[model samples]
Target: MKTLYDVQQLLKKFGIYVYVGKRIWDIEVMALELDHLYKAKIISNKEFVSAKLVLTHEHKIEELKIKKLNNGGGL
Candidate 1:
């Protein structure tokens, strides 16, 4: 997927929805679910890798946002 939203949409297509009251946690859950789907052959390696990349990128961004906030910087 090109973006986190795209990854979320892909997961939704598989009837997977995850929310843990935190964006980073949600992304991590999505990544784990994607891993399961990949292992089950429900998604191709390319699709899994793409979605994982998006999720990783989003997770990093969220972490940076949190760090910024903790450092007294506004997002």
Candidate 2:
């Protein structure tokens, strides 16, 4: 997937919807679910790798945001 929305749509195709109140947590949960799907051979390696790239990018962004906020860098 290219964006977080694409990853979410991919999960939705399998009847999975994740909303953990926080974006970072939601992304983390989605990653776990994606792993399960891959392990079950429900998703191909390409899909798994693409989804992971998106999730990892999004997760890093979220972490940076959190860190900046904690450091009083205020957006």
Candidate 3:
């Protein structure tokens, strides 16, 4: 859960594949799936927290990139 790829692999283990054609959208969907898994007690607290940290970090990075692109700096 150190990277987005790790988070994706975790989700994939449960047959959850998310690709909404946009990085932000995909991360959002993955968050939802993670929430569901956590609620179902399918994942441990440590795994949930680690995955969330990864997702949140990645989401922020994507948001920053979008902001930069809109501001004319671009990625």
Candidate 4:
């Protein structure tokens, strides 16, 4: 998918909804779910790779924001 929202929408189409009270946790859960779907052949390799990349990128961005905030940079 092009963005995290797009990946979430794709998961929604499969009746998957995940939340763990934290954004990073939620993204991790989504990644796990995507892996399962890929293994089960429910999604194509291209779709899985695309979604994974989006998730990873978003996760990194979130982490960087947290780091910046922790470093007293007001994000």
TM-score of each prediction? 0.90, 0.96, 0.94, 0.91
Residue-level lDDT of model 3, residues 4-63, one tens digit each, is: 999999999999999999999999999999999999999999999999999999999999
Q: Write the per-residue lDDT of candidate 4 for residues 1-75, one digit (tens) a residue.
A: 699899999899999999889898899999999999999999999999999999999999989988888898953
Clash pairs for candidate 4:
none
What is candidate 2's lDDT per residue for 1-75, written digit by digit as tens?
A: 699999999999999999989999999999999999999999999999999999999999999999998997854
Model 1 agreement with the true structure over 1-75: per-residue lDDT tens digits: 699889989999999999899999999999999999999999999999899888888999999999999997954
Q: Show the lowest summed lDDT stretch of 10 residues, model 2.
A: 66-75
Candidate order (lDDT): 2, 3, 4, 1
So what's the TM-score on candidate 2? 0.96
Measured on C-alpha atoms, candidate 3 has an lDDT of 0.95
List all candidate RMSDs to the true structure: 1.8, 1.2, 1.7, 1.5
lDDT of each: 0.91, 0.97, 0.95, 0.94
Candidate 2 Cα errors over 4 Å, as ranges: none
Candidate 1 collision pairs: none
Give the TM-score comparing model 4 with the true structure, all chains together: 0.91
Clashes per model (N, Cα, C within 3 A): 0, 0, 0, 0
The C-alpha stretches of model 3 lying farther than 4 A from their native spots are none
Best by TM-score: 2
